[model samples]
Target: MLRLTVHRHFSTSSAFFANRAIVYHSNGNPRSVLSALTFPSLRSPPPNSLNIKYLLAPVNPADINVIEGVYPSKPSPTKLNSDNVFVAGNEGLAEVTGVGSGVSGFENGQWVVTGKQQCGTWRSGANVNVEDVIKVPKGASEVGAATITVNPATAYNMLSEFVDLKEGDWVIQNGANSAVGQAVIQIAASRGLKTINFIRNRENVDALKKQLEELGATHVTTYEELSQKSFRDKVKEWTGGKPLRLALNCVSGPETMSMARLLGSDAHLVSYGAMSKQPLSLPTSLFIFKNLKSVGYWQSRWYTERTKEEREKLMEVLVGLMREGKLKEPEHEIVTLGAGESDEEASNKVRDVMKNIMEGQYGKKVLLRLEGE
Candidate 1:
């Protein structure tokens, strides 16, 4: 039998229990298991942890990549598992249904979500340290809060960390229609900056333009259009010689080089992912004369390593934006994978959601359909 030590709250005579999870028994693949195998509960909830009853969790591509054993992050062992296997998910919104003695800033009925790393969040309940979670505003949408991690935070930090773009300065990004891209667009717009967004061609190009425009995009163009000399000329005419200060590159390889080329001198190019599975290429001139900078980002690393006070400040900024309706979670197609849900059905849901996100089928975030909401 599997032997594990958890806080003293959970004990089971049987060797197994159930919690919904996504598992990749081997590399390069993954599937969700509903009512999946479980083990002993917490012997006692950690002294400072608040037992979270999950409200919602996002199904991010990075989460999928982790399941495929492609992402660099590795989950830690927790009492939630029966055989001590892994459960996969990035960040999610929860409620403080139970709190450990001495934990402050949390109480029953308060809404909250993860603000740090190392605590697994896919299942129904979680024992998270008070410092690792942030109290979400009562009026915030659980769906939107579920997306507070990774994309939203990444967009906020990258734009804030890189060169300070003024109202007239522009930011360019690819996977522009991606969730992070959308977040960047909104945040920049709310901050009075302009945006030059690029996206791959999809089935409904016309519809997509209206959507981005509504989100305050200054301009939206396809990859092919961006490669044209005339397009760059047209861009110069529209921007009135003000160069793009930052290029957020998620799908690297040649696109990374192209984004760098589009920036003004002393511009910063931040690379967060390599969706194209291609090497990042750059021209020598950018490094030598233009003084261009390329930075890599992984939100998991950022959240875990940053100080607790820093986390609170970041969360407060984002929540304030949401309160003003300046920030938002993507519109979503929700897929439930919880109690009484079948594994086969849940597997199909995950596959469909992944396809839609990667292929740009849905113009919104794909959330794991949850029970509480």
Candidate 2:
């Protein structure tokens, strides 16, 4: 379907090497964080692994972080040949091309998605343990392929993780405008839980609040309004004394303190991101007198270490909602890959988009699409 060359080793400061790629390539070095390119191998594995041909892969901030050396979750290299090292992408919807001699659950041409508890997420194909891939639902949309790893799972888990929030209870969160935040609002509402979402006032605060409320948010307030004591009082009255039990956060610093105070005694406050990138300042009294908790939620850690059967169940529920069109993927920029695309061409396109984020004008995730889907 497509052809290009690429390198898989990271012996230098640059994240990965690029020879050429079926995806794209830039001349010499790349300006985008992804290596000049990454390529799939043609080498044969010892009879026990399945060869996958990936259809779609998500380009997340964490994926960018991995390329930048900021993310701790890095894939170890595997020997494919004397010259080529194996690079794997963790989350992508793929199809099986070659089944191993002993593989049981899959056959050639079966559509699958990698759920291997490791990262192999950027390439076009993979050779993995047959037990590692999960069958994707039939007729799964191509556009929905690359977008389901961390945020959606985080939104699903955090709500049900530490507490069993009853129908009338409330869960508040900062960064309520993010994709995860939107998912949290939707899922919580489906369970009849109320949400008090907080966000930085950008364009159309009123409109944003209305949109979130339509998704079942109880209230959508901004960072500035968070400081007033009356706002907390209003939240208290709004909950009608049913108790605010959870706070899912990304922005910390001052907002954390304010949101923390809004919770009932022994309420759980889970911080998922450092949007402010500032350290959380906690008052000892919140822990001692109010019995409030400050917990950090890293979705990858949970995905790797927590309950699998349960997690898969949640994913099944999520995918069903998506199929029904009640839940939709975020709006994102798509980088096309096809019959004869170059790594540099893809890199240059991504560089422009990253420049947009640095300039504070970009929103939504970016997905890389492969040919022959």
Best by TM-score: 1
Which digits, one per residue and each the tens of the lDDT, describe model 1 over residues 101-195? 88877778888878766355666666677887877765457787888877888999988887987877788888887788888989999988888
Off by over 4 Å in 1: 1-28, 32-35, 38-44, 338-364, 369-373
All models: lDDT?
Answer: 0.72, 0.67
Q: Which model scores highest in lDDT?
A: 1
- What value does the lDDT take at residue 63 in candidate 1? 69
Clash numbers, per candidate = 10, 19
Q: TM-score, each model?
A: 0.85, 0.84
Per-residue CA lDDT of candidate 2, range 1-373, in tens? Answer: 1112554333222233322222212122113334424443545544778887777776665644544445677655543324333242456767788887877767787877666644455556567776566665553465564566567778988998888878778888999988889989888887888888998888888998998898878889988888886797788688887777788988888888888888888889898888898888878898999888889888777756745465556567777767876566777776665434444554565566556655556576666655432
RMSD of each: 4.7, 5.7
